[model samples]
Target chain A: MIAITIQQGRLFDPANQLDVITDLHINHGRIIAIGEAPADFTASKVIDAKDMLVIPGLIDLSTRLGEPGLEHFTTIARETKAAVAGGITSLCAMPDTDPVNDTFAVTELIQRRARQAETAYVLPVGALTKGLKGEALSEMVAMHREGCVAFSQANQPVVNTQTLFNAFDYAATHKLLVMMRPIDAYLGKDGVAHRGAISSALGLPDIPSAAETLALARLLLLAEETGVRLHLSQISTARAVEMIHDAQARGLPVTADVAIHNLHLTEFDVADFASFMHVQPPLRSQRDRDALRAGVKAGVISAICSDHTPLMHDDKLLPFPESVPGISGLESLLPLLLALVREHILTLEQAIKAVTHQPASLLGINRGSLQVGAPADIAIVDLETDWLFNRRQLMSAGDNTPFHKWPFTGKVHTTLFQGRVVHQPKLA
Target chain B: MFGYPGLSSPSLQLNEAGKLKHLLTLEGLKPHHIQDILDRADGFINTDTRQIHKQPLLKGKTIVNLFFEASTRTRTTFEIAEKSLGADVINLNVATSATKKGESLLDTIYNLEAMQADMFVVRHAKSGAAHFFAHHVAPHVHVLNAGDGRHAHPTQALLDAYTIRHFKGADFSQLRVAIVGDILHSRVARSQIQVLNLLETEEIRLVGPKTLLPHDASAMGAHCFTDIEAGLKDVDVVITLRMQNERMSSARLPSEQEYFETYGITEERLKLAMPDAIVMHPGPINRGVEIASTVADGPQSVILDQVTFGIAVRMSVMAGIMQT
Candidate 1:
């Protein structure tokens, strides 16, 4: 393959602590050199990124591709294209799919589809328990060997504490990373939103913060005993963040990520009983949102993921409680993070690091860097470009985002996957 | 308008001209809109005493009682209201309906629509079931919520308001009304509070145990009190709510006797209110649980009168919405 050179862009590589205006040379799908290219290097293509900010491709810790079962809502090909448009180069696939991703065959199916799409790298997370029924442990060792990145039950906590302990023990012995989304199923009790004044007034059932913190406390204690590398997914409550902070302070091998929606939206957004705002660990109070932002700044929260679970079109058309949970978040991820930057909650460097190096490090991946010989995965972003995010213009079949028609200030100019332009806006 | 719940049923309940398309909730009903219903109900109250009890207003209209959640009192009252107005009423047992065969709620509504039903009287266990039907049903067909899960019971509220206006006069701003019993699980309590606020009542007090009271009662414009005596002090009306037996398992009440001792209205407790204070209950009353038998059957008891007013109030709402 011929070489490509990206010229005169402000490159920010958080993993190497490098931020400067530079040119990068890529050959054979690897970053060959930085700044001045070698004398023997010949550039077949050059991208003019003079006024753009180039950063390491974003890594999402949790995203639902809906390939095996829910392809009508979104297939791997459709969602990955949207992910690349949002500057995401890699995403961790959730295990909560049709038939569940508990077996090696199911994990392999996801990998095959992701390879066929060739947009973003997909790391399948195998179900912690068989069929995700929470009754018995799945073949974690075999699935891990099949290239499953992590083991998780997702939002479905194991049926009993003993089952969770057994799963933890098995995962510990296998030296595998287990992603736990802390929620006490009994406490959640079929609730669709946060239990507060909004829920009370709306006459809708609420899922209180206790649902998250209570389950998180038990999982952290078990992780401590089992000595498993535990990663908490989508921590939304302030109390949960504080507990994770304390666990990390006491030297537990623990890492936690907050979904981008939790940082920007709250329970008040669901006042109209808008089905699109119905997410698990339901959008919390404004106080919780503030604390989550603080957790990200304090480094207590190591990563920010999309938590992109897209639903069928009619699934969210029903009344509030009966509607499904989750949002189509891949396309809105970077715009929301830039909104955080615009609000001064995070600097541009911190925002980039949270989506790139922090998540990449948590997943133990080698791609979230711009060092020599690293994969040429990069995203060119225009910080000042304003755009309206209408769902009709988006690529995902789900089109179920709550932020449809919202005005956004940042836009992804181009995305590169292994030295190839996977997504770029067509000039008007 | 300030403390309105985030969910606006206005678009579903009101037509484009802002008329009552469906009797879903009393939340957004204007004072004039409520007064019109009360005034129209005044014309129906004396119909039984007349030679002919039938009216030609809704003569050929077909009303369907689509009760997904069973209610003997609400169903009977709505049926009587429809029959007295010379309309045909069909009561469908939803459990044995096509819904049992895994058909969706909308499919049931569509079947009813195909049958040319003019209105749907919906009593569902879900909070927004009535609103859901109202939004999706045929535009010409109206919907009336009998009671929905902890949401609203508009007819019950209308009847309660009529009873209060009958004895205490239409100038409700001078009256103090206390609604006592399980406020958390009672759809009646939520609806009553909305109508009471719309009537501009002074000092609406909600009396219940902490566990039985809603966390957002005060936000709905009521002074919440755990002490029944404090809530009843000098109130012009004392409204007691029926305590369903299932509340014990729901963990909202400790025991039947404990709830009776704490929040139940007694003859002596009635003395805490004004001398001529009228007691009310949305019936099928557990005699000794939510109120004493003496207080429920006494001269001050307007519980039976509420049943009498319920038919007239429902007639008023049905006629108002079904008007061509």
Candidate 2:
């Protein structure tokens, strides 16, 4: 492997509490040194990162690469490429694929495809139940051995409380992390948006905050009883954040993440019936969005994820309620985080940490840092450049972002994965 | 042109020139635009001759009645309006169409557009279905929303307004109108509120059980009252909404008998309003559930007039959009 030297960059690694202008040396796909190279070091290549911000590559907690099942909408290869372009070096691929990631074969298949793509690292979240039917248990312990990062139901709820309890108890016994997007299936049934004045006026079916708070209460209690390491995915409501805050304060092993979209958008975004704004655990109220931002600031919400579920153009061309939910979020993640910084919703360091270090810590990964021994997964960003987000710039197969045409500051100038230049867009 | 109060995107119902391209919702429509529609409806029905003269306003235009929901009354009124305007009409009950066979909505729309559909009277189960159709249809094609989930029924509101105009005069400033029952689920109430507000109706009271009312009922520009008698008191107009049997199963209400005992419109309750005050309903009324049979069939009831005016109101909307 060629030795690479990234010279004169402002490095920002929140995990290491390092923010300084320095040179980073990478040899044999690992960060060999920082500030100064060794006497014998001879760089095969050099990257001039002058007037740029170098940070650890983002680690997304939840991203759906629609391969092995819904590849027609998007593929693992396409999404990973898009993720890399967004400076996301590792993506925790969801388990809601065809032949659901309940088996070793499916888990292995996803990893193999991701490897072939040679982009971001794909961490498989094994399904909590067989076929994601929520009725029978899957081989969590066995799948964990096959490199499943954690187990999740991935939007499907285990309707039977006994089945859910047993699954939690089993996961706890095996010491596997269980990720749940808490929503009471009955309460949120047939709902397409948040229950609020806007949804009521628009006449869209509404999912109440009680659906999340009630379900979160159940999960918190189950996590307490079973002693399971619980991670709540896509916490949307203020009450849910309050519950998680209380849970963490009480010393129940629980962590939560809010999607990047929820931090910025609210139910008002869906008022025009723009199908792109239709997302599951649907874009909540402005108060809820503010609460989530506060949750991120207060550290009750430890990480922010893309919650990137890409769908075909036709999938979103229907009516709001009938349209498929989710945003093709990888490319928008960095810019939107930068937006928070610009708006003073979060400090730059806090924004970067939520994506990189915080998510990495939540997943128990050794990456998302620029320490000497760590893999050279880094993003060189031009913080001063402003660009309009458009479909022509979208690398993902799904052009389903609501942020299209939005003005965004901060652009990824270059991305390095394992010390190799994976994505370096030419200056326009 | 006034921007729609709650719509996040620019109203698709209007063109760049601010002309009526589609009649999707009344939320963004100006009072003059509404007055123009009501005025056009009056021209269709000659008061002196007591006849609804069929106009050739949409002589060669082809209108498609694309109903995804089952609504015999709404569809029939739209069909009559389309035919009355001398336009060829095709009724596509999508429940029995290619949609049931798994075809996408756009695919269905494209297929209809290919057949040269000039206008579509869309009644869909989903709230934004009409807007969805309006967005995807050909530039020349106009969309008229008959009803969508619990969103808006602009034509129904227009016809209801027309009925009120005929009996109570066009001046809505003095009208203390009471809209009783199911404000949460009634698309009619949503559109009625907007139309009433646009026409500057004084004191629009929403009377319903707390469970049947939207959480932000007051934000919808109406005084919400749980007490039906208090809501009906000295009101110039009473609009009773149907209490669906489905609400009973959904735990919204205990029983029909209990609902009738509390919120149901009766002759006794009718006395609380002005003696000559009119009663209206977007019917297929649940005879004894939301109203007593006597009140529904009484001289004060303009339930049948709403249906008659609905045809004219729809004809006016169809002609208005096509001419634009």
Candidate 3:
């Protein structure tokens, strides 16, 4: 393997409380040294990373790569390419694919496809229920053996509390991490937007804050009973954040993440009936958004994930209520995180940590750090570059994003996965 | 009505030159634009006979009635309005159309556009369906939202406004209007509230059970009332919306009998309003549920007049958009 040296870059790894100009030495798919290279280190390649920020590659808690099924929306190859381009070195693949990731075979297929894709690391989240029908528990232990990082029902809620209790109990017995997006099936029925003034004015079906809080309340109680390692996904409301905070304070072994879009967008963005702004656990009120940001700042909400759900153009062309909900979020992730820093919602270090160590720790992964001997998954970013997010520049197969034409101040210059240059923008 | 401010987005419903391009919502419309519609509707009516006159305003234009939801009254009124304006009208029932054959909405629109349809009078089960059509339709084509899910019914609001102006006077500032029943789900009530608020009515009162009323009712520029009698007190105009039977199944109401007893308009309840106050409803009315038969058939009831004025108001909107 060729040795590479990244010279004089501002290495900012929040996990190690690092921020300094340093020379990083990489060889054999791992970071060999930092600051001053060892005397024995020889470099075959040198990268002039002057005037750039080098940080641990992002570890997104949730991203949907439409492969193993629904390839027409997006493929693992295409989405992984998009993910790496946005500085995501690893992303947890949601379990709600066509055949779903409830079986060992499905997990193996995803791992194999991801290996061939050779971009970001794909961590498969096994479905908590068979077929994700919320009726019966799946082979959680077996799927875990197939290298499923965690188990989740994705957007599907286990409506029967007894079934949910059993699923959690079984997961606890195996010490499996269970991820859940809280949603009371009855309360959130047919809802496409936040239940508030905007929805009332636009007349889109509404999902109340109680829908999330109610489900979260139920899950927290069950997690307490089963002693399960619970990771809440897509926390959207202020009440949900408070509940999670209270649960964490009580040491219920809980962690949570908010989708990147939910932190920036709100229900008012859907006021014009822009179908692209439609997302599940819908963009809530401004106050709710502020509370979510505060939750991230306070470490109550530990991570900010892309929650990238790519869809065909036609999927978002329907009326607001009829349109499928989600944002094509992979490419927009880093720039938006930078935006939070610029807007004073989070500090630069805090923002980077949310996507890196916080998510990495939640997934129990060894990635998302810049320590010597760590796999060299790094993002070299030109933090001062100004650009507009255009659909034409999207790498993912899906162009269904509400962020098109949004002006961003930062851009990824290069990304190294496993000590190899996986993504580098061609110079103009 | 003149210079009612900040009601709806003119950009979505208007052309580049700020002319009416689509009648999606009455929320952002200028009061004079609404007056223009009411005035044009007046022009369609023969003052002596009080009957609509057929015009050739849209003689060469093809208007398609695209009903995604079943509607007899709205579709019929839009068809009558199109015919009165001398436009060729085609009715497409979505349930029985290519939509059922799995053709997408865009494909359906493209097919209709391929047939040289110039305008679409869209009634859909989903809110913003008309906006979706307006967004995707050819630039030359216009869209008129007959009704969309709990969103807006522009022409209905206009006709109700016309009905009010016909009985009460052009000065809406003196009028206190009460909109009763399921305000949360009624597109008619939503549009009526917007139009009445834009006209600068003295007060817009929304009367319904808390469950049937939008939580943000005050934000829409209206006062909410749980008691129908309190809401009707001294109101110059009373608009009753049909309570959907589905509301019962949805746990929004206990029963029809309870709703009638609590909020239903009766002869005795009618005494709460001004003596000469006009009563209106976007029919078909549930006589025993939302209103007493006596009140619906009463002398002050302009329920049937609303239907009559509806044809003229719709004709006015169609002519206004096409001519502009």
Candidate 4:
């Protein structure tokens, strides 16, 4: 019975490449009409867009969330809240956890949990190999039939080259997407951040760029040779992006997402020696960040993900050499990225596409674009709202955000998932 | 003085009175005195252009290191440096002693003290344990603190200053050195900061989360900030600290994602510092957490050199104590 209308609102529909003055209509949890509200559509709720742009719910194909091993780090409930805040209606989660998502049971559990959160739709990534060990192929075929949209190893690198090639072949045969973190064990051994001058100064063990670049280089060959689809979970280096760009030109079915943390920050964040800034496939150089950012604009990196690793204080309080690496982005992902769009550094369409259509297409999801007869999954954001990040207001279960006091300019005013209000941010 | 453990109380400042007093923790330490000791150490280290690389400063003295904290690098540096100065050195595995007989703390100290111990190099579990014992015994017994529970490792600080002085040359009067990382529970930081002040270093900044830094550290003459860029701005030397996790028993930290956003030191942030600024950290670094591997392995990052110099630093510390 919550019927609302926006008298005037500018709308940007990327799918149709149209910018029009359209008033969207919603009733009983579905968009009954879009062009105009019916005469019978008496208003219980009404919103005037005021000529601000509106689009379909954003989607991210790759996000680290609902981590099974450490619920305290991030739970389905908190992640869903964060997802809604980020304007993301759908996401594909990584499969590397304590037990892993190699089996269909785990995938089903993830879907159930996301549903319980009642916020966003979660597509689980089934493990490519049993337990991500890469010794034997996982039942990718079976998982696809079981509603697992993609297959990937979240944190673990595909160690065996032949096994990885076989995985690509298997995924292609099944017409399933396989994602992997690009890190070569031999080159990245015991390394954390980008391995070069910074490492000598910080006294940390070194992780060579070859770890990221070589992995992509090898992945390119694997995809070309096997003619299979591959998705780099989080591309953190420039060389990886260039290699991927070349592979795409070569017509290899390869796709990648730059972790939001990777795109937004660089290796410099760790110069302060703050362990919380640490991340896997560690934050790369500024050149790498610039390239990754450019990749998003150039269309080489198709999506951006919040490689959110929710850790209570103890996890990061350890000596730099012993602390865990990862960041939480569910809460700040949209605002931080939107600020970029606001700055005109990136077009809103391109940015939205990175979070939505690009990622949605990667997952084969029907949720990113606003089309006639599509589900009314919507998110209303305050385009010009401004607020400093206090970390206290974020929905993350853990309070360890790196942007504790930084100011942000975009915020989710209201989030509707499957035509239901899941989160309504307090007006600033 | 560079021979560390070479001169018995070089009187680098040569303040009046008593034999060598071990500095384990600076909690109750006269903030002004830590500087004087370092000045004394520096004067000697500066004069010894020893191409001989060998000096008999602490000659004939017997040194024993009792390390509850496992630091082969620190321990080795001391042993090698002390031996070079012609002192007999011994290391004790005290961690197991308590486990076998459940010996109390004092009993062990008394036992060690009776072994005709000329100078004791102690790294213990208690913050001020070394300082406590330094005052407990007669003046003849000399002690040098290697490290103590999240307290102060004075010798470590001396070596850090020694390295900084080596790079910056004598006077640190106006030098800006930022210590980045877990300062709240870092014994190395506590001592390092004290030494930075001792060397008259100005603009000593502590960069990390409010949780990672000691509250009111600014009162201790440090400019505190959560942002690395702001902290790194125009700084001459950047000393990155290892994130201190041993202090946390359970959990309540922000995600690594959040931390990296605000604190990770990438090449971009490095531009904020002077081009020649060096990076320093206590060993066992979480590369990506506190620092990105790119910068940690980068040229400006003096981390490896810090590790390399750690040997010499420790060598000097052992030399000083044995000299007594």
The candidate that achieves the highest DockQ relative to the unseen native structure: 2
**DockQ of all candidates, in order?**
0.35, 0.58, 0.49, 0.04
Reference-based lDDT, each prediction = 0.86, 0.89, 0.89, 0.69
Off by over 4 Å in 4: A1-7, A38-43, A51-53, A71-74, B1-38, B42-324
Q: Tens-digit lDDT track for model 3 on A283-367?
A: 9999999999999999999999999988887788788887888888999999999999999989998899999988998888999
Expressed as tens digits, the lDDT of each residue in A226-261 for candidate 4 is 877778878888888888888889777788887777
- Candidate 1, residues A1-428, lDDT tens digits: the string is 66899999889898898889989999998899999999999999999888888888899999999879987556999889989999999999999989799999999999999999999889999999998889989999999999898999987888689989989998999899999999896885768778776666667777888989999999999999999899999999999889999999999989999999999999888866677888987998899999999999999998999999877756766666677788889999999999999999998878888999888888888888888898898999988898899988877777889899889997999999988899998989
Lowest lDDT block of 10, candidate 4 chain A: A196-205
lDDT by residue (tens digit), candidate 2, B116-202: 999888998889888888888889989888899999899999999999999999999999999999998989999999899999998
What residue runs in model 3 are displaced by over 4 Å at the alpha carbon? B1-8, B100-103
Query: Under CAPRI classification, how is model 1 graded?
Result: acceptable
Where does the lowest 10-residue lDDT sum fall in candidate 3 chain A? Answer: A197-206
Q: Score every model by TM-score.
A: 0.91, 0.97, 0.97, 0.64
Worst 10 residues of 1 chain B by lDDT: B96-105
Clashing pairs in 1: none
- The model with the greatest TM-score is 3
Winner by TM-score between candidate 4 and candidate 2? 2
Real A-B contacts recovered, model 1: 0.27
